[model samples]
Target: MDSRLALAAVVCAIVLCATPAALAQTVQVWTRGGRAYSLTCYTRFEVVPFYRPPNATSLVVAAASPATPPALQPTESGVSTIAAVLLVMSCIIVVVKSRSRAKFEMIIGKNSNRKENIEELLDNYGSLAPKRYKYSQLKDMTGSFSEKLGEGGYGTVYKGTLPDGNPVAVKFLHDLTSNGEEFVNEVISIRRTSHINVVTLVGFCLGASKRALIYEYMPNGSLDKFIYAENSKITLGWDKLYEIATGIARGLEYLHRGCNTRIIHFDIKPHNILLDHDFVPKIADFGLAKLCNPKESYLSMAGMRGTIGFIAPEVFSRRFGVVSTKSDVYSYGMMLLEMVGGRKNLKSSVENPSEMYFPDWIYRCLADLGSLHTFDMEYETEEIARKMAVIGLWCIQVSPNSRPTMSKVLDMFEKSADELEIPPKHCFYSAIQ
Candidate 1:
């Protein structure tokens, strides 16, 4: 229990203990709404110390009345019945008053006196756990921003600590730059939304150009570090990889179709994808997120957004028109290809020019299911290759109109393996396999 709360409790005990004479004089009658009332009644006894366990307070409090008349003298049986009725009424009054006081204590329940809300302890939510710092107190929380974490186009991030001594990640934006708007948007988006797959925004910091966003520190760091690591054979195994893929897709689906406002993740890539303690994927960094009416097809930006390699071909085309949410679908498709290939989609490595070409190879793989077996044979490779090839190929289709909606892509995932149709080999690599 908090020392202050304990002290308050002690005060409550003293005040209650000190007012015994008044308490006895006017028995407080209470209603369910916590209001108190008083009623006058005949009482031969009063309740004693009720707060103490094993020996509850009960003291005899009697009321005086006129002496019984000789004409009203009762028989032995009648007197016994009268006594029984009076005793029962006294017990009821004592029980009600005791329950009322206990109830008052309950309404005043505090987190200092008890545990955090049950939902906070549970997952499937992204909460800013017990905010222990006010703006002035944040300097100690971030260790004066001494611990450098990472830097991005938007701003630099740092590591921080809580009064409870738990460590957290904080991203600090340079207040003098345009990055402040992006940081504010990210905080607003995350605070309003929560899902198992969404990155939990722990809190935020605002000071001039020194704005910062706090997140639940992920121990493993970003997904790009693992996938793009040099000579590392530590593959995110089939099950975990599948979960990561599905979780990211679900997060995107929620943004694209589940949210009250349609969100287009203009920048969806391995670098923006983070992993949690359980290895579940969390979609992060929405600096490039564009909000638009779902009823519309395009949201014009200053220019095309997102990483160069992942951007949709149509988006980069000189003849192609404005960018749309499907642009993200195209980038996600490329990301899926990278996951399937276990190599960069557009490898700048001079040794193999063909390595940069992914969708074409995937198209060739789909034309010949035999090639599917060679991809991550340790996995249910044939099935994965087939599904990835289908979904990926569909997402990267030249015309955005041809690509399946996120809901349809999810439906395609749910359908049995046998039910999925292998898309026709129509790309330039179609004749190879």
Candidate 2:
């Protein structure tokens, strides 16, 4: 009976704590011992606690009273608002990410076909004749003819990435007015020879009206970028310059003697020389190359086939000498002199008469051996400069017969610089005067 009575009291207190009118009502209460109990009741929402005096032996329930809430409201509305905002942000992020991914996929899809075609060609050819590619495939390789590396009289070159992730340079031939002799010559000349110092023909494209050549991409690009410009992209040290000059000479020698037929590179200049990843020089651009019978000591050509500054005197007039491998030698010599001097061989708009012809100025400096200080060169560099000057003067002799052969040029490279004999100044000086 007593336990039931205590339980009833707790239930009443809970009701009073939850209801305002019930809490306001007061009720007299009795203990189990039949004693009147005085109790203090404290109520919080949905729960109540009672404090009893030491003399009290029973529980009491005060009438429930109306409860007033504190100023701070419930958190449900704020929580709902935050959840809604998060949902919208998440949806927006998903949409944005999807669009970005779709755009990237679309770009990849455009180039993928070209990559696949190039891979197929590489698989089939395996270093035979340069692989033939369709025009669409070339477009993909070159990214719609973008990223032009350079342009020449023949065509423009672009930088491209192969499907297999290898980089390549694509040379697109300009529309020709006459028969495509330049294209045919480049294909034939480069295809016939394979040497370390010679640029490799990676592939070619002859689809529809488009004609293009793909070559192994040279990372450092042409030698002229380093040689001609005062603020060159990459400044080559004297050692590197000498190494490039020697490599060019060796390449020319291989073209002359190593091939089945003697190949004369009618155009040899700094711009035609390309540098690979390690700065190894490779002779490139054989559009003007001529293949001759090994027995033929002289070749007769109808017209000149080289750059103006580097052209051999014989190529301009037969009065100088017969056009032969010696013509290439003469061109190589002019390029070598430019490499040594770090400037062009000829300048049309020069104010100083002595500086009008670079070869003459360099020849005068080398003859006296005292002008080395003017160049601000070190001991080793000074020696290399003198040797290159001596050999260059030898190769550019007015008479084609007076010029040393490519083989003799290589032999000279092997010897110490001190052992080289400076060629006597000839009609070249007189012509310039």
TM-score of 1: 0.59
Best by TM-score: 2
Top candidate by lDDT: 2
Q: Report how far residue 177 has shifted in candidate 2, in Å.
A: 8.2
- Candidate 1 lDDT, tens digit per residue, 1-433? 2443444455344434644433323233311111112243334522323244676666675643458675576444343333333444454554465557667778667522333333232222344332323455567777787888776544566778866787777765542333434434445555666777777776765444355667777777787877666532356665566667778888888878776567777778887888877888888765323321111122234354556567665665535434667777877777877776767765566365654576776666666554565455654656665676677777766667677777777888787555777555555221111
Flag clash pairs in model 2.
20-65, 20-66, 22-64, 23-63, 23-64, 23-65, 24-64, 24-65, 25-63
TM-score of each: 0.59, 0.64
Which digits, one per residue and each the tens of the lDDT, describe model 2 over residues 1-433? 3443454456444443533333223211211111122122221111123345789767675644446353344333333333333333443444455556668888799657655654564455456657677889888988998899997655789998888999999987764442334344446556667889998888777654777788999999899878887743137777778888899999999888897668887878888899999999998876433321111112234555666677788787778889999999998999888887777877767788887688888888877764466677788878887788889989999898899999999999888777987788775722421
The lDDT of model 2 is: 0.70
lDDT of model 1 at position 283: 82
| Colliding pairs, model 1 | 45-61, 46-61, 47-58, 47-59, 48-57, 48-58, 48-59, 49-57, 50-57, 175-209
In model 2, the worst 10-residue window by lDDT is 27-36
